[model samples]
Target: MQIRKAFRYKLMPKGEHIRKMKQFCGYARFIFNRALAYQKAQYESDNTVKFSYTRLANLLPEWKHEFE
Candidate 1:
């Protein structure tokens, strides 16, 4: 027999915290959109090209540096 315990806590974000959270969300959205667009473009150029997580993961640093 085994027993497990779990706890959940709600966030109480203040003004500054909310602002930072929004900024983080926006950055995440940007990264997702960029990745999707890259995949789309690659597919359009070569139909046989399948999605490659490793290739995209490798590009993350380049994307971050380019965007920043």
Candidate 2:
């Protein structure tokens, strides 16, 4: 038999950390929404379309250049 323990800690970020965290969160949301919209379009255009992680992974570099 084995025993396991889990812990959760609350975070209190400083000003600069808070700012960076917000920026990251915003960027993540933007990317997620963009990917979701694209998937939706593909589905609307053709019901047989498959969802792909590689497809979105390929878009990351282009998105970075555009957003940055």
Instruction: Give candidate 1's error at residue 67 in angstroms.
Output: 1.5
Instruction: Kindly report which residue pairs in candidate 2 clash with one another.
Output: none
Residue 38 of model 1, lDDT score: 98
- Once model 2 is optimally superposed onto the true structure by TM-score, how far is the C-alpha of residue 64 displaced, in angstroms? 1.7
lDDT of 1 by residue, 1-68 (tens): 99999999999999999999999999999888989999999999999998988988999999878977
Residue range with the least summed lDDT across 10 consecutive positions in model 1: 59-68
Stretches off by above 4 angstroms in model 1 are: 1-6
Query: In candidate 2, which residue ranges exceed 4 Å CA deviation?
Result: 1-8
Q: Compute each candidate's TM-score over C-alphas.
A: 0.83, 0.81
**Reference-based lDDT, each prediction:** 0.94, 0.94
Lowest lDDT 10-residue stretch of candidate 2: 59-68
Per-residue accuracy of model 2 over 1-68 as CA lDDT, tens digit each: 99999999999999999999999999889999999998999999999998999998998999889887
